[model samples]
Target: MTDSPLHVTVKLNAKLQPEHRHELFEDPLDALLESAELGQLTGGGTALTDEGEVDYGDIEIALTDPASLPGVIELLEQLGAPKGSLIQRAGEPDQPFGVTEGLALYLNGTDLPDEVYEQCDSNYVFEQIVERIEGVGEICSWWQGPTETALYLYGVSFETLRERIADLVATYPLCQGARVVKIA
Candidate 1:
């Protein structure tokens, strides 16, 4: 059986102002699912349903190729215009550990072989992991900020991440000023 493309659902906080609320969808069907799923995930509305509760509160995107994830994430950031906080993860819910800030990249350690530190792309790494472990192996998610937006990705590759970062830097001048945190 063919596997389903990874599904990402982005939920915007209810407190955001109307002006900041905007919607961007790569596919119409995925957009519809995102709206429905986000509403369900966040619950109805705190006030009333008819009040037009935060129109841009949710977003969804489907990804098949892991290499395409970083680019997809860059697009989401551009469309949503994030203000704060970006996080990424690798693998499924119970077993996920690679996380990155600023760029919204994550890697799955469990999926990798003991010595496979570098790979062509995050997606390739995931694929390799899957081959060894019998699971799909690539998963990632991102959040724009408090009331900004959130996104999810699956089957992503490191080469994709590098390309995406380059694209982001070119497209968003602000990315040039981004700082990476290092631990000793």
Candidate 2:
């Protein structure tokens, strides 16, 4: 099966007061889309969710890769938006690692395959790892932290997954470093 597109939810807490919420921007949706990198804003009429979760507005976009998530979040943050955003598999996002800060991989069990907890500081690089080793065991659950992300996985062996992780670390940019830890 082909890989799923990234479905992202970006929430914005506008810097405006309630009375002036309508004046947050001339065209808030347009203002938001200007900063996007990989995906485009899908609809035309009213893309705003008006879900009341955000003080301002919320928009959803579809991206080709989860790796582009960091860029999307960065743009939203710059505009005082995306207080927090989540990405999921376009198809079955509600599944494990389906939603997360920047990106996540929720896995099963402890004592990973080879005592190897492959990780990198850059979400972009981590996205590469996800792309390379996806569709193994169950979906990966990830927690994107300030400095790094911890990815929990299952069903895959260390020798196999590690080789690909190592190869990605060696070949890609933004993933200058990686660590494999044994969680006892």
Candidate 3:
């Protein structure tokens, strides 16, 4: 049997353009600062201080299994920004998988259109999962395939991941079916 991987969630606060708020992106500590600067100049938001930096607010990032980091980064780049970036704050763990306190599950599926896939980012999926699990304490885990295929999700025992998968499969008209798989 494989052992569960250790995971750590990081939080970052940044300054961004309020106007371009919808187009913001998520990044690590260093990237967040750079993105915030660029976002402020492009989005037209004012820097809270005279340092020419816009306050993009805070974001909480959950790193599940750590092995998924590369995939997560790809997802973020595709999506405009990180998930739950609009509401998350520092010093928060985004609740727990169950107990109605944190993000529930991670989602994976296929059959996504080129345009849709291009528009999607890790942050987008991450935020979607967070929204679904909010107050319910679950995580939604699923994946989108390139063609007509089943959405398979594994390693999601948290309520947040579970609910997220359920919601995405239900809400997204593109998906046909969703299923859960055991983590190897």
Candidate 4:
């Protein structure tokens, strides 16, 4: 099945002049598109000839996976976006998925030993995984519900994470039923 597209909207800071809006958001938007392997804006644009109607630094894109957001956020941070620059889902009321500090691996179904949890927590496991692959940011483990335990990681390349965790679960039977989740 095709993944549902997510609308990524970058709204400019008011301090930006209308004339500079396109230049400011253009590269970041392109970076988001390139990193996500996406094309085209979903909706909205500034008036070309009417400066009075022009809005500052707004760019929108439709991304294929919610997981792609972190890369875009990282790129925007690198681009030196203004303090009030906003990234959000186009039509949603809640904050955008990009706001999530990290990705989470939700492990449920198996009731592993407490010692296993202590030893294979996100930080320890992330350290092990990153030795084989280069990944940045923090990760740690914790319980989310009565039955659900999670391994949360800050920076992620989603596919890399899935493969790494699949390997981890292969060696550690305790995580056999883990499902990668994004916690925003």
- Alpha-carbon TM-score of each model against the true structure: 0.27, 0.30, 0.26, 0.39
Evaluate model 3: give its TM-score: 0.26
How big is the positional error of residue 80 in model 3, measured in Å on the Cα after superposition? 31
Candidate 1, residue 67: how far the Cα is off, in Å: 2.2
Worst 10 residues of 1 by lDDT: 39-48
* lDDT of candidate 1 over 1-184, digit per residue (tens): 1255555444432223332333222343345435544211122112213443222244344545445545545544544323331223335342112222212222332444434434323344334333432222122233344322222322233334344444433433223233322110
Where does the lowest 10-residue lDDT sum fall in candidate 2? 95-104
As a TM-score, model 4 comes out at 0.39
Overall lDDT per candidate, in order of appearance? 0.33, 0.41, 0.36, 0.53
Better of 2 and 3 by lDDT: 2
Better structure of 1 and 4 per lDDT: 4
lDDT string, candidate 2, 102-125, tens digits: 222322223334234354234565
Q: List the residue pairs that clash in candidate 4.
A: none
Runs of candidate 4 exceeding 4 Å displacement: 14-19, 35-40, 47-55, 90-184
- Over 103-135, each residue of candidate 3 has an lDDT whose tens digit, in order, gives 212233464556655665555555665565555
Best by TM-score: 4
**lDDT score, candidate 2, position 160:** 51
lDDT of 3: 0.36
Model 1: how far residue 99 lies from native, Å: 18
